[model samples]
Target: MGGSPHTLCVPAGCSSSDDYTVPDALCGVTVGSEPLAPLLPDGEKSVCSVSVDKKQAVYVTDGVTDAETDPVAVQRDALARMGNPQKAAVGDDARIADQGGVAVGVCTYQGRRQKFVTLVDLTSNHPVPKRTADRRKALESFLRAYLPKAMEAKGCRK
Candidate 1:
């Protein structure tokens, strides 16, 4: 596997038992057994991009406000479910409300075999109902295209 130039040390006070690191400036880490390339956007520098090193994937945070957005909550809940499948039923309402409104991606690291979830905010100027619908559609499209590959690469089912 290829070595990643960036290392993300776990911050103090985190209760996770896994020792994970990510590239500098990335918000998430990847996991797998193969060499993973950093996901970069064309012609962009540090504003919007995602990168994954062996066994670790990193996503740059966009800092979109989520306090008033059900989609954000739905996305978070879904990721949590990925970590614990049993929790899927708990956030169904939020999930349905935010349907097609959230964006998600995954990356893998060959070193630790861990997958990280990446969420992108897609705020809409349309009315609340329309915005939510649009967001859900966009997110669903992204997941359909990229998620299966990521799951296969990471050896995860969800």
Candidate 2:
């Protein structure tokens, strides 16, 4: 809300993508952090953190909606507007807000271990961002630029 239209812009900060090796345990992981696990009876691991919080519209473009776009304020407005459903059905015009944070984390997806830098939503317990191709590519691009400068250790290039 305090910031510009790019509210809660965390600046997409991340650790070095190449900061760590595959730790020998995950050397076979040729693929990135795509989820290889099967769907459980419960809806677990069905989402990624990289995607915007689309449960509801964070900011309504309605003339009466406030100009403030702070993450907390937006969430409050969105939930209130959507009647606080446990799960909200989003429409196309609903614009979600910035997420919890951005960082590179080592995670096991589909049994393959890989490093990924993307926005993570800690409040909701989501690990990485969404598994979409475009999201992955954006994370890869961030890592390519961030890892070199952040890690400085020459041997571990991505």
lDDT of 1: 0.30
lDDT tens readout by residue for model 2, 1-158: 11111111123522533211111111122223322110001121122322232321111111112123233333455434422212211211122222222333233333444333222122323322333233333333333333333322212223
Query: Number of clashes in every candidate structure?
Result: 28, 9
What TM-score does model 1 achieve against the real structure?
Answer: 0.28
The TM-score leader among the candidates is 1
- Residue-wise C-alpha lDDT for candidate 1, range 87-145, written one tens digit per residue: 11111121212422223322234433233333433222221123444434434444343
Quote each prediction's TM-score. 0.28, 0.20
Question: Of the candidates shown, which would achieve the greatest lDDT relative to the real structure?
Answer: 1
